[model samples]
Target chain A: DVKVTQSSRYLVKRTGEKVFLECVQDMDHENMFWYRQDPGLGLRLIYFSYDVKMKEKGDIPEGYSVSREKKERFSLILESASTNQTSMYLCASSLWILAGGPGEQYFGPGTRLTVT
Target chain B: SQELEQSPQSLIVQEGKNLTINCTSSKTLYGLYWYKQKYGEGLIFLMMLQKGGEEKSHEKITAKLDEKKQQSSLHITASQPSHAGIYLCGADKGYGNKLVFGAGTILRVKS
Candidate 1:
């Protein structure tokens, strides 16, 4: 079974604070992603890394940045957190392909950040 | 931009009843994925359908992709309280790797 783990389940921070959320996958997958889930708006992609040291912006990546210094770990960074950034953060990882097709993503439990 | 629309934003069903959730896309789908998410938890993958007119089942949960590959339905038979959660459908964003998800349908099962 594949397992994805996040560094924190919940966190609270004041506005303008720098926040870091970490994710680690045990399956040695080559692709990792970060997303934020909000009520009504659904999950919006923040960033995705296809390989170590490689990153790409998704639909919504203005306030967020990502780091993939190693294969097993991916980190989401909020250079300066704002109250509007408070939401559930999700991390997912998957192989480039499975059975010659697009692979299914395995997600971590998530980190619920509260920016006050 | 690609978008996925899920119908019946929320549903309430009684135990032993059957219910279905639909996901529709404006463009052809390369792949469709079904996932269930408990409150405050990550998404649990339920099924994946790639080919049009394909159907797959897991226990009492069944998912079908339309012939046009632009729509999919997830049906649950003999519903149980454990089935209550948010159902989200994801579509391959044509980039061959990224995914775009629907707003999600929330299901509440009463015993």
Candidate 2:
């Protein structure tokens, strides 16, 4: 079975502080993505890395950036944390395909960030 | 921009009852996917439909993509307590590898 792990389950940060949320996948998949889940707004894409050192901005990438220094590791960074940035951050990884396969997305437990 | 909208923001069902969640797309759905997430958990891929008028079944869940390829439905038959969770519908327009998700439907099942 594929396993995706996130660095923290919960974190609290002050306003204007820089935040880092890490995710790792054991399957060595080619695609890694970050999304934020908010009530009523759903899961909005933040950023994604299709390969090492290659990143693309998803629909919602205003205050977030990502890094893929290695195949198994993807990190989500918040340049300046704000109260609005606090939400459940999800990490997902998939193989190299636009259309996913059966049980396509392998996700991490998620990091619940709280900015005060 | 591509958008997927899910209806019935929240639902309450009894055990052994049937429930359905709908997903509507603003643009053509190159690929539609269904996922489930327990509170405070990760999203679990349930099913995917690629072609128009396609339908697939798994256990008690059945997902169908309309012929227009712009909408889809996920039906849960004989709902159980374990079925209570947030159901999300996502779409990939074949433009990029990233997926766009809908505002999930929160289902609460009572025995």
Candidate 3:
């Protein structure tokens, strides 16, 4: 079984504070992603990394950045947290491709961030 | 850009009942995935369908991809309280690893 773990399960921060969410996977997957889930809006991609030092912006990447210094770890950074940034953050990891098809993503338990 | 639309934004069903959720895509889907998320929790993958006219089942849940590969349905039989959660459909955004997801359908099972 694949295991994805997040650094924090819940966090609280004041406005304009810097925040970091970390994710680590034991499967040695090559792809990792960060997403934010909000009520009614669903889960939206924030950023993704395909390899070490490689990153790409998703549909909603504003105010957020990501780091992939190593294969097993991915970090999401908020330049300056705002109240509107309060939401559940999820991290996922997957193999680039396995057996001629895309691999299914395994997700961590998620971190619920509250910005006040 | 590809978009996925999930029908019946929410559903309420009695235990032992059967229900189905549909996911339609604006463009042909190279890969479609079904996931269930408990409230305030991360998503758990249910199934993945790639071929046009393909179906896969796990326990009491079954998922099928339409012939055109633009639509998919998830059906659950003998529903239980444990089945209550948010169901989401995701598709590859033409890129192998990138995905676009639907708004999700909320399910509430009544005993």
Candidate 4:
């Protein structure tokens, strides 16, 4: 079984505060992703990493950044948190066969962040 | 730009009833995925459809992809309260398997 775990389930921070959300996968997968899910907007990708120290910006990567220092872990960083950034954060992992193929993503339990 | 649109933003059905949710894409889909997310929880993968005119079923839930590969439908027969959740359809536009998702359909099954 594939398991993806997030560092926090619920978090609250004030404006201008820096936030870090961590994710770890035990499936030895080569791809990790971060997404922000909001009502009526669905899940928008924030960042994705295919290898250690390699990252790519997704559709909505303006206020967020990512770090993948190791194969099993990926971290999402908020340089300066704001109220509008308050949303559900999700982390997912998948195995990358060759360059790009149909791989099912395994998701974490998600972290609900409240920026006040 | 490619977009995945799901219809009937929300649905409330009685237990034992049958309901269907639709997802249509603006462009051709390389791969389609269906997931279920409960309130305040993570998404649970339900099914994935790649080939056109493909249909897959798990227990009482069935998902079908059209021959055009631009539309998909999820049908749940004899729905139960346990099936209440938000159903999201995602499409892969042949870019490193990155997915674009729909706004989602919220299903509320009342017993």
lDDT of 4 by residue, B1-111 (tens): 689999999999999999999999999888899999999998999999989999999999999999999999999999999999999998886777678889999999999
Q: State the DockQ, from 0 to 1, for candidate 3.
A: 0.65
After superposition on all C-alphas, the RMSD of every candidate to the true structure, in Å, is: 1.2, 1.7, 1.3, 1.0
Q: Write the per-residue lDDT of candidate 1 for residues B1-111, one digit (tens) a residue.
A: 878999889999999999999999999988999999999999999999999999999999999999999999999999999999999999888774888999999999999
Candidate closer to the true structure by lDDT (higher is better), 3 or 4: 4
Ten consecutive residues with minimal summed lDDT in candidate 4 chain B?
B91-100
- Can you give the lDDT of residue A48 in candidate 4? 92
State how far residue A23 of model 2 sits from its true place (Å): 0.5
Model 3 misplaced stretches (Cα beyond 4 Å): A98-101
State in Å the error of residue A34, model 1. Answer: 0.2
Task: Kindly indicate the candidate among 3 and 4 with the higher DockQ.
Answer: 4
Flag regions of model 4 displaced more than 4 Å.
none
Q: List the candidates' TM-scores in order.
A: 0.97, 0.95, 0.96, 0.98
- What DockQ results do all the predictions give, each relative to the true complex? 0.71, 0.59, 0.65, 0.75
- For candidate 3, what is the DockQ-based docking class? medium
- lDDT (10s digit) by residue, model 3, range B1-111: 888999889999999999999999999998999999998788999999999999999999999999999999999999999999999999877665777889999999999
| Cα displacement (Å) at residue B26, model 4 | 0.4
CAPRI grade, predicted model 1: medium
lDDT of 4 by residue, A1-116 (tens): 77999999999999999999999999999999999999999999999999999999999999898999999999999999999999999999988865544588899999999999
